[model samples]
Target: MTSTTVRPDLDLTHARWQSGTQGMGDVEIAFIEGYIAMRNGGTPEVPAVIFTPGEWNAFVLGARDGRFDLT
Candidate 1:
């Protein structure tokens, strides 16, 4: 599993969370301030995963290349 350490000093309340579906499911993914947050179905809470600009770039590239595919 990919792990990230959330900064306690970051105030996410004002953060603009852009939500979208990850392929097909009730699960939701949110992006804000270089952080990606996921909320599963039937859940009310979501933890934000912090990522650096470089890491985010790599993730995007990998995702585009289907490196995260699960079949």
Candidate 2:
């Protein structure tokens, strides 16, 4: 993967999100594959997390199941 900075807080609704190395670059999304991608809009050169669709679903499910309880 390419070394990059993070830019979280980016406006996704307005971002022209794209994939690969041929995009606006200003967008805040990068399609990693059929099930995952990178997202970072708080800094411009920090690496971001990549999550598969299934993994994301599991996380949401876990949160709902109290697996992420914080008290």
Candidate 1: deviation at residue 37, Å? 5.7
**How far off is residue 47 in model 2, in Å?**
2.9
Clashing pairs in 1: none
lDDT of 2 by residue, 34-56 (tens): 43445555464665555566776
Question: C-alpha displacement of 38 in model 2, angstroms?
Answer: 7.4
lDDT of each: 0.60, 0.54
Q: Write the per-residue lDDT of candidate 1 for residues 1-71, one digit (tens) a residue.
A: 99765554455565555445355655554566556554553453555555656677888799899999997
TM per model?
A: 0.57, 0.38
Q: How many clashes (backbone atoms < 3 Å, residues ≥3 apart in a chain or on different chains) does model 2 have?
A: 13
Instruction: Compare the candidates by lDDT and give the number of the best one.
Output: 1
Among all windows of 10 consecutive residues in model 2, the one with the lowest summed lDDT is: 7-16
lDDT (C-alpha) at residue 7 in model 1:
53
